[model samples]
Target: MTRTALRICPLCEATCGLTVTLDGDRITAARGDRDDVFSKGFVCPKGASFGELDADPDRLTRPLVRRDGVLTEATWDEAFAAVQAGLRPVVEAHGPDSPKFSASLEQGGTPIAVVLGNPNVHTVAGALYPPVLLAGLRSRSVFTASTVDQMPKHVSSGLLYGDPLAIPVPDLDRTDHLLIIGANPMDSNGSLCTAPDFPGRIRALRRRGGRLTVIDPRRTRTAKLADEHLAIRPGTDALLLFAMVHVLFEEGLVDLGERAAHVVQADEVERLAAGFTPETVAGPCDLPAASVRRLARELAAADSAAVYGRIGASTVEFGTLTSWLVDVLAVLTGNLDRPGGLMFPLSATGAAPRPAGPGRGFALGRWRSRVSRHPEAKSELPIAALAEEIDTPGEGRVRAVVAIAANPVLSVPDGDRLDAALASLDFMVSVDPYLNETSRHADVVLPPPPPSRGAHFDYAFNALAVRNQVRYTRPVLPLADGQPDECAIHARLILCLGGQDGADPALVDAMVIDTVLGKAVADPHSPVHGRQPDGLAAQLTGRDGAERRLDMMLRLGPYGEGFGADPEGLSLARLLDHPHGIDLGPLTPRIPALLRTPSGAVELCPAPIAAEAERLRGRLGAVPDGLLLVGRRHLRSNNSWLHNVPALMGGSNRCTVQVHPEDAARLGLTDGEPARLKGDGGEVEVPVEITDTVRPGVVSLPHGWGHDRPGTRLGVAAADPGVNVNQLNAGRLLDPLSGTAVLNGLPILLTPVR
Candidate 1:
């Protein structure tokens, strides 16, 4: 029998609604849900091919355990037993007498319990359970994809607003002038800032007489849609933005408007930016002095404007400074919190709006890593430092690792070193669907059921979405016989960490519910105040612990029904009735109310940010010598994980080094010929792709490649395995403030292969 089911695409940040057709456990087709409230029938290539991804033959169906140095299939019970045996010692060893775990006791519990979170942490059980597990372990040794991708933005937001999670998204639907720097939303479908049809939004912006300006090394797909595109030098985003600030102050175009009362350090910003005039930074940025001033004028003169930057502005030596200046421009132009300007999203599941007042300010470097002493940012150690924490022998060395949907070997910088570091670990476990580069090193590999068999919710992406909307997707297909729910697997893993291997996984969920309900009932502001926790637990509705937890979150959320207090507000049952989704309307301005700083206002120039700006100012005259390297994005790809899907394998997504025609001619490089490229980390011979899109002094390589690692099971990916760009980084260079790997603006030596 054939049946159609509606679900949300879990592949990327867009979180578009998917209409999947299944015939007896096999996914046949996937298309856009026309009635979807947020996406509005928009489906990207990844969403359209969800069926093939869900039914990939290479996806493991059973748990695997390492026996005598070999991975072999094992029963679920055997896998749990093995995990309990492996991880229990690390969790129990808390005292300094335990030589195996000697991390600083002052920071937290033993540093033995470590976790590596992937981008997928935004979806599925990954969003729900991993935090619980980490909280239960109480370990300071944690790593996530954020450090490598978006940590700078988080740190910048934390410095400006007291909360690290309070990030602002561009009001794409209403903005009149959009200035995009170092991001290609057409390919990424918008990252950090989430929008379903980013390309469509750009087109609509053009139709509405809105001006779009893109500043990047290459003229990406997003840039092509812009009214103007500036092929700027890589890694000079901070310099360019600072120069823009200079022009704003010098030309008397600085307008804080309604933000005057809510903003601080305007004079400090002017003093800091005074030295970075357009003429001073034009040479390094490869842009004319006139162009820089004109851009500032356009931004300030526009009725509404938003300055947005992504991975390109981040993952650099001055990443944190660039991120901070992006918001500084928005504020200086009076676009921080207004219609057709940059604003914060009010998610349905987010905390209820609190009275704007002095709050506990955000802090950094609370704890330092053992070997390098790199300070922790937002409670996560830099992914760039994970190798040394595991390999270096000391009091705080990582003895065991728990990776959830992560592939640090391929994702992080210096894969060769991290690969060797994993081998030396006493034990490692990976909760992933594929046994690729990173998971291959695990002692036990637990594969979660495919997306079709699991429910969907965007706990993370929803908070970053351009619009305020809510959606849910029930399982499109039933769980296979004898297969366990992904949530159950996570719960069992938590139980194992807690030294109860064979216990019912449901107990883990129950304990969480009890703890949450107990806290809620005791909170004076809670709607259920004075109500018994046991009574509320009985009133919860769901088929399992995961859904029940969702129900609880929805009931307690800002737009929630408040347990019958507001009958028409959101609830799990209401979401179930509206399968496509419920449009909550467009983003509204949230300023003083969203500010959580100790000052109850936006801190324009924090000390740390000011110090970093000085560092950027010092580099205003220093010029980059060689052809700088930057990364590119392909619409067909979403990091290294998605290349294996046959439906998305071909077309313009092939891996190659993109070099500007002028640079190719100057270096005697030929198109379609391999070229030797060496950087601070290492070297690789990649085929040259000659194009005029990139600036003359810059070359581009798409990240998330190098599927050629041995002992992997990605059939399609390995066949055409591309070279790893991270290998060229050598893992030494990093952004000092954010500790993010410097993935872009790296100087490299290039020679054509004869």
Candidate 2:
């Protein structure tokens, strides 16, 4: 028996570097790898608990199948056969499009071959998959967490810069002033901007004579660190941003000439913003007119300032508009793409690529749900409509489904409704690690091996990271007997369902070898490379001689005659040599140069957003005496994943209705008392935590809890299962443009549950 030190971290999108302490054959402890360049030894509480995930007693060690309405431990063959039998018919009848697969971005062992075998598999990170996978699916019905959160960034970037992937990263390191709206980067660990150790970054900014401001309804973790915190009303972010821009234009504070060359619809944006003066929109957003104007002036006067907005702004009724206006403010202030301002990622591929199409906004009825008429994005209806599509009888109905890693019944809007829909499916198969929540409804459950057994790539996170860097995670251990890898299980499913035999064994072997060797070549110290080698070039050419051209070019490129094997240059071997991680460098602004619009200018005030102005004003007029429900995020939870991890679930799991003390008194409720929240879908009784952290007339709840699944072995999470907030959320209300479920900003009635 021997012990070895390994560096790996796969907790969330942050991908912090980790040092695993091993004792013989067991992992004794985990700590942050201080020498890592990207994270710089930063590790979150979640990442520190990797040992628990590995040793959890409830972890599925073998496959399981439901027979006679009871789940029984079974062999891998039995499980695969059951899944194949159940899903084959669905593939035959509806084609691959009907059998949608949803998996988490971090799940291990998902077979790329199986995923690519069928065009129907839907992943949250579909944008990062290989070209073969993307080309095969070919349908607009695809739905993702992006539309519900960061679609605004994509849409705005595309409209203004001509490149959707050209999203701006807030250069916190160099920024003199940073304004964060509707976000808490401290807890989220920098959403859409992968900055590890965010707390330290904020502290450094303040230490360097920089200022930080947070505009949020709650005194979030990030707010506590801010130089100033503005408690604005929920769902009113767009208004606040508009007022900021309005003040900039009205007070002669804006440097229009600075941005004149890059701005596309500057005149249109100026005219539109004029209507949203601080005085007019301040009342709706519950902010003082003076504060709005002062903030706008501060932003405009700053030598370099960037306004960052995320989830809170993108998951509302006017998400697209709010997203659009945030960018408008950045551009109008002459900070759209500048150092110490909003900067773009310098990608290996130049820019984030999008699916080729009309390049217009979301369209309706291009493909509708068989039962609910819910608009389709690619070939799939929104997850919110999954239940109706399965239960309703009509042409193109979803009679069966093959879910991958995703627990939609718990994660989607209207959980109770989705559970019922899962029950109605003619056949259901789940490729997951546990028979919890959504998988309990499946006829067969195919579990993949643990994370340590899978090769890791941050394809999706790379596109969103604040800096440009790429790293691959190689499995630290070999697969155990009687269990198949994620890729193998997925491949089996695709082959069985498509009535096709498994891929050539040689091809499979070659792909696996390529992936492993490519990862090693990216490192600077692999045996194949006598010394340090450029991993990116290795990855590009690790295959049969095809990547040789790329390797030759990199060897001759200006960066160096040969891939510098040192930390100063870019190469995988160098990255591996130093386990701590390497800093790729700060992000730089790339707006007009990356803009793809016909006029080669940023579309500041696009027509689609302009046409909705009257409607926005009308909605702004109706915001009186209404309680808007919003969702909050915590560091401990990774949506539905961490509930089963004991260390993270030691405390409370019960959902809390965060109401302002004023609202609590007004509703005759007290802190820690039961409160009934009623909505169109249903009502749920949750405990109340009255705190001024929440603005008056607004209520908050952390999403992805309330696990009521029977036979689930998660003792910790089950001990204090929270109420499902989605049960009190309406599925009908959605962003018209993105068709993203409006998870926040629903008007609901609250009563004391007694």
Candidate 3:
């Protein structure tokens, strides 16, 4: 029997490198690629189950078409024809703007052509695929995960650094102090970045005389590792951040010289922060005033410090403001754009990568709908209004939709309403591997090949990588029988939509292979590059060589010769000589010579963010007295995709409402009892998990569950389906400026489900 070694793990954003032991054509066992420069042999349980996802009984091996309200197995050509027939008329009658496309940020598998071909599509794949597509689509009716979750960071980054994508990452390896707010890196690995072996990094931080502090409503895994954990109220991160800034300014502790010239609206920031003393905002934030003051001082006294925030900061009523304030605090403390402080990651490739875009800021008491008008932001009307947009009689109505790799019925706000809107669509198509809740409504489902068959690139995560390192993986196995290449399938769909294909598929495929090998060959940063060429080649082949090609492209790319560039340094054949992985050094901050703003200096506190503060105050007056809704995360699930992987799903049930003990008592609900969570658009009955981890009056429900589709063959997910929290989350209640749906801090009534 013949053998081939390969490394490719598509579990989460971590994208950990793996080495599969192949016996002839069968994959026998998988292990972490020991010499992988990025992950460094850190493989999670999900990575171990790659073969399971490949051979799972639930895997869709063939295309299925809906005929007369029934789905039947069909040939790829037949399925393509059906998709074209169904979607063409909708685009013709309603215009391309009628369709909306959404995808996950975990992987950039969607072909660029599909997104660029249509002016109407939208997605959540940030910094990587979206920019490439945005350059092509140029449509105003766009929505992404950024606005709904990370817009605050983008807005904040823009205010502090002139570039919205210049998000500051905490230098865990070098910093003496780290202040984390509203983010749980432990569970998320690293939101907006690929930080594999996070626990190990945290441990290293402590070993190097660094101290970590966490400010969150829950004592998350990341918090447990911290030297101190401050349990504050949700949606009050901005106030907390502002209080910290106030402390820095009042005590003459601020490094004004570093930011004085670049600082815009300094007077305004000082004035706003003056009103938010620790004592003044402590009551609303539910944290001790003295502790807040102490934290501010400690952060200031440290040799080097950085502040970081994520989904917890962005998904709230004041998400954008909170995100902005975190950056403000970083800038005021002389931490912005500094080593051992808040720093930006440089992209290896020549591509100009911006982590977030500056959308329109917040809008005031905008007209809300009776059914769900949530506010409009950045021209994307609230998702809650999706049903209305589809059903209401009017011009430019959403008559059709083409969702790529997203299950809005379970993932988006007002899932029930979105489901209804989907059902009402004149035409719909889903590019997914399963018949999920959203896909069940599609006229045709265009399934892409498994991750093992596609090339690997952390195009999105590279800009946010904890360490500035790059690696690529080729597929360990060949494309499964009769399955169209993922890119080809997407290209065909885009062509069907009446648009010209951009990149040649063959070129892309070859480039992907070349890029992976090139990176491996040229990587001076890799520990094994000079020693283990065969192992490197095995891994590069698994990544479809895109990783290698991307590295090569970056070296010769517009950026000009990254750390690994050398004419005689490396090649694909050289990588084939090694079998172990390679090593890249720790990531560091990089600010390119071209700042791009009118002024070369970083813009501290830009005008757009200052305007948003007033909008936030006018819209969400104060925390209401009802159960405040918030979204929570889990380590195993990667939005809607991971539910299909049995290994990740074998653990304890992850979907449940985390209610405060006091609140659970008031509602007469015990642990394990069902609670009916009601909002403006819909309601869902979820099992209660009474825990003091949550603050009183606030209830937490895990996002990305509630799979109720009869057609989906996810046996584990179907058997243990949880409530679709998005159903209760009406998109109509949105941050008008950013057009981000308020997924957190929405008022909802809860009662024990008898």
Candidate 4:
């Protein structure tokens, strides 16, 4: 029998709707869901290859336990028993902090450490269960992929709005002018800002008379379609942005519009930016002074404009400063919180609108890592420091680890060190679907069932979506024999880690529901405030504990029914009724209510942010001279995750260094030949793709390669194992504020491999 099922693609941040053609339980084909309210009829290559990826022969179907120091297939019960035997001793005897990626490590009674990967936010269980698992384990500390990816943006948003989660995205559909720095939405499908069919949207913008400008070292696909491509010097984004700011202030273009009443410290920003004029920074940024002035002038003159930046800007020396300046430009031009500019996306699952007022402003550096002494931001230690934190023997050294859907061995910097550190752990477990680079070192590996056997939801991406919307899908296929859904894997894992190994998995969900409902009823502003927790629990509905938990959340969410408070509002039942998903409409201005600063106003010139300008000013006119390394994104790949899938491995997805013809000639490098690219940490000899896409002094390598480790079972990835670009990262260079690894815009040496 052939049947069609609707599912939101979990491959990337775009979160487009997908319609799968299933033959019985097997997914035969997948295509864009034309009726989807938000994504319309758009599906990227990643989405199209969903069936192949889900049915990859490399996917582990059973748990593997290390017996006699060798990983062998094991039953779920045996896996759980191994987990209990492994982690309990580490928690009781050695303590959990293991030297502090987590502040609770000092308090110690929980698990040693838990590291989450980028894929966690992509699924239902991933989005909901991680917090529960961490909280239940009293996890001394938690490390997420944020430290290596988007932490700077969170830090900057925290300092600006007094709430780290109060991030603003460019109004993509309506904007008149878009200045994109270090981002290739056409390739990435948008990160931080989630919008499906990003390339089509860009095309739409162009057709609608909107202008798009890109500022990056390499002319990415998005840049090729741009009105102007400013190939600025690597790691000098902050300097170029500051130059624009100086131009805005110099030309008297600092208009705050409605923001004038709520914005503070404009004069401070002006004084700070005074030193980074176009002329002063032109020599450093490798961009012309005239171009910088023109960019600033165009932004101010545009009917509506926005500045959107990504990893290229955030993974640099002044990541937080650069991120701050991106928004600073938006605000100065009176474009912030305005239509066709930047606006806060309010998800259906987000809290309802409230009057603007004082809030508990976000703070950083509550505690420091015991080993590196790196201050914490949003409770995350620098991922680049994970290897050192584990290998450095000291009080509270991490004796055990739990890695969920993460392959840090390839994702983070200095993989060789992390790989060695993982081997040294007293005990480690990985909740992964593949025996890949990182999980191969685990004492026990529990594989979650295929995506077809798991329900889908976009809890995290909803808030980041360009348009407000809600969507949900049940499992497209029943779980195979002995297979457990991801939610069950998580719930059972938490139980085992917490020393309640045989307890009912339902207990985990019940405890979480009670905890949330109990807190909600206590909050005076909550719709269910003063409502009995038991009563609320009884009102929830779902097929299992996970779904029931989802029901509870939706009932309590912003657009939720409030358990009858608003009968027509959102609920799990409501989402189930709309298989194609419900569109909640476009984004709107969220100013006073969105600001969480102590003053209940936008803090334009935060002191910590202002302090960075002086450091940036110190580098004025000091031009960089070397072949710098930067990472590129391909339309077919998303980090290291998709490489193992054969369908996604060809075309432009191959791992090779992109070098300009000018730089190649200088280095005596030939197209299709090999080059030894050396960096602070190490070096790798990779094939050179000579092109003029990149600037004269820079080189580009795609992130997430290096599948050549022994004992790994990735047949496709390991066959031609591409080199790991992150190997060149020393893991020491970090943004002073965010601790994000300098993944891009760093000086490196490139020589022809003779």
Cα displacement (angstroms), candidate 4, residue 622, comes to 1.9
For residues 1-754, could you state the per-residue lDDT of candidate 3 as single tens digits? Answer: 7564656566666767787776765666677877777777887776787777766667677887888888778888888788768766554443334332222111111111121111012111222233333333433334344555666565556545555566667777677898888777777776765677777887888998899999887867898899998887777777778788889889887874354555556666876666678887787777888998998898888888878787887777677678777767766777766777877776555343323323333333233322344443432334444556566554445556666666656766777666776787777777777777877888778776666666554565666766776555555667877887665665566556643333343443353444455555555543334544444334332233234444444443324332334444333333344434333455553443324344554555556566766664442235445667777878777666677666778454378899999988888998998889899768988889898877788888888888776767787688778778887865666554455667877788999988
Per-candidate total of colliding backbone pairs: 4, 32, 44, 5
Cα lDDT of model 2 by residue, 1-754, tens digit: 5554555566676777777777654666788877666787788888888877766667778877889988888987777677667756545444435433322111111111121111112121122222323233232234444544566566556555555666777877788899998888787787777778878889999999988999988889899989999998877888888888888878888775455666666777778877787888877888998999999999988888888888888887788788777777777777766777777776432222222223343323355544455554433345666666556565445566666666766666787887887787777776677767877887777777776665444545655667766554455566787566665565555456645434432233244335544554555433334433344434443322212332332233222124443325443344345444444566765544555676666667766578666567775554567687888888877777678787787444347889998888888998888999998778888889988888888899888788777867666677778877788775887766556678877888999976
Q: What is the lDDT of residue 152 in candidate 2?
A: 57
Cα lDDT of model 1 by residue, 630-713, tens digit: 999999998888988999988999889999888898999999999998987778889999998888888999999999998999
Q: What global local distance difference test value does model 4 have?
A: 0.88
Between 2 and 3, whose lDDT is larger?
A: 2
Off by over 4 Å in 2: 1-4, 96-141, 256-259, 348-381, 504-579, 651-654
lDDT of all predictions, in order shown? Answer: 0.88, 0.66, 0.63, 0.88
TM-score per candidate, chains pooled: 0.98, 0.85, 0.83, 0.97
lDDT of 4 by residue, 541-563 (tens): 99999899888878888788998
Model 2 backbone overlap count: 32
Q: TM-score order of candidates, best first?
A: 1, 4, 2, 3
Model 1's C-alpha root-mean-square deviation from the true structure amounts to: 1.7
